[model samples]
Target chain A: MIKENIAFKNLFVTVGTTKFSKLIDTITKKEVLDILQSLGITFVQLQTGKDFPGPKLDPNVEQLCSIRSESGSYTVELEKKITLKYNEYFEDFNNEIEKSDLVISHAGAGTCLEVLHKKKPLLVVINEDLMDNHQMELAEELENQGYLYHCTCNTLVQALKQDFSALKHYSKPEKFVFSRFLDKCIGLSDGK
Target chain B: MLRLLQGLNFKNYTPRYYFIASSDTTSLSKIKELEQSVEKHKQGEYHICKIPRSRVVNQSYITSIFTTLYAILYSIPLVFKIVPDLILCNGPGTCIPVCGLGFLLKTLFIKDVKIVFVESFCRTRTLSLSGKILLYLADVFVVQWMCLKDRIQRADYIGQLM
Candidate 1:
């Protein structure tokens, strides 16, 4: 049973660059939109332009006064400013990440790590043109860790509309092992 | 010595770029075709030597020797003469050799020469086995997008190669 007071059922996602990465489906924006719609979520989008900050913010939070001006293409600045703005728009954004049942983020492993740290149930989309499919590799690792759901935009929406707990259960052990592996690989064992 | 290497198709030509590579003499023979095809075309100066077949061990795995040998044999002497500040490496296969030579010349002779790796792959992240080695050797690792910069620890994320 889904709840009613939801302020952000659909997420308008953003990315940092407009380059040739296949991770974000440089060719598949409409596919992403269709999936989001199928998930019973509204499609709020923020494709990056060459502006300093990158794209537009979530429409609801625009009322806040503490919002600072971001730099780089409009879309870039929006992504950079999101965390801080979320802090200011706490209730609205919190409900958004929590009640919406899913948050789809286009950030790479670093940003995905942050989303995982927040314990949000997320769908991570990886672009293809990355070095060794590092983003997908990381997504595989994170999916193993049980941190979030990882897929191309199309797969993600399909997975989200169904029972996510099944996917979540399978991803847990992998995420755990991956976290340990990362700790060892990065030599952060002492948590330093 | 601003030499370019390729089949020299009129489609790939830009103003004043040199043609240095071709798959075979059929392509080599077509250099004249390229010359006459474009309105702004200039005559071919010299033909690039074909890289003989050989085995190469890429960073991730073993590859044909031709990839490493040809790039090195053909590009090194050019680097010594032209001393390009930047080598827009289309991939590890081609750019690695130019960069290796660039590093050697800069360390042993000329100083402050820069090599920029032009990332052309459309999907996947993390440096290719050759790219992994080239990253340490290159002066600037330019990615097509900043998103790539996240996965790559040290690249400059210059937002596109072309």
Candidate 2:
């Protein structure tokens, strides 16, 4: 059980490089918003990919923009309390992931692996609207293996409200498979 | 593959990592991440090559032909210049031309290079278009799922990559 004083206060939301409007809409729901507010999550950094008509931004909500100066000076201007990025990629995506306590993302293999590699608490929301439906299969397999949590739009709110402290810490594979594969490739190359 | 190549003790051989990706925002960003990772770790030497994006879906025949020709022409110089000992690729449309160039070099130029192709994990139920073609080209063909092992005659099922 999570202590009352300890709660995840920062979230990194990404719909991956391709837009998943359903997942975006699910997060913006009133119930979900209320839950997020009550849980003391003060900041949400959203990386909404192309094609998502972003949620209506409240006038009072804080908006932050990272701008680069002529001499290559990077500065983040924070004006609002909440942040929303519409149809753009984050320049420092890894930095954003590092700063957040939890990640809410669409079920893409690359995105999921990145989050798990970082040992971040991740909740994968699969987009059923995809043409292939392979993301659903991958998400389910990961969820079944206790690597991460998976949900649809219908179950997202319930998932967000769950006690995530009890979830398993994803242990990365000890032996680097790619390295092993490369070794084999080198050996084969030597045969010539 | 770049990360793996970076950690190797290249005693006598100069390890050069080559990346071929389609010109798309997602692909470019991933390449950027890999570049940053290599830089941050002070890893191996690498080169990223871009290919014109082509897909069977929603593409005109003329555009497809032009893209294919462009990929082949671009890869000719790269394949000959690098003359890599091994070419490692995953199933993707972009890999088709690169792997083909490697095969051509081995067959025509008598270049000693081995091509290893790993089927993408997403292809659990079926072989992707690139995977089907690479089945004949790759010296070592690997599949992540056991279900695919029986389907591809030469494929070695290595289990899921993730």
List lDDT for all candidates, in order.
0.46, 0.67
DockQ of 2: 0.26
Error of 2 at B110 (Å): 1.5
RMSD to native for every prediction? 18.5, 6.3
Q: What is the lDDT of residue A142 in candidate 2?
A: 69
- Model 2: per-residue Cα lDDT over B1-162, one tens digit each: 333334444442345544555545665666567555544344445566766554544466678778778877877787788888887788666778888888988888668778988877656657877788898899988886676688877888754465
Q: How high is the lDDT of residue A165 in model 2? A: 62
Give the C-alpha miss distance for residue A191 in model 2, angstroms: 13
DockQ of all predictions against the true structure, Cα-based: 0.02, 0.26
Q: Candidate 1 on B1-162: residue-level lDDT in tens?
A: 111222223232233222234444544555556555545534333334444322232243345554567667876666677665444454525446667788887888675666655454332345555567777887666554455578888776532221
Please tell me which predicted candidate would have the highest lDDT against the true structure: 2
Model 1: chain B TM-score vs. truth? 0.58
Error of 1 at A84 (Å): 54
Under CAPRI classification, how is model 2 graded? acceptable
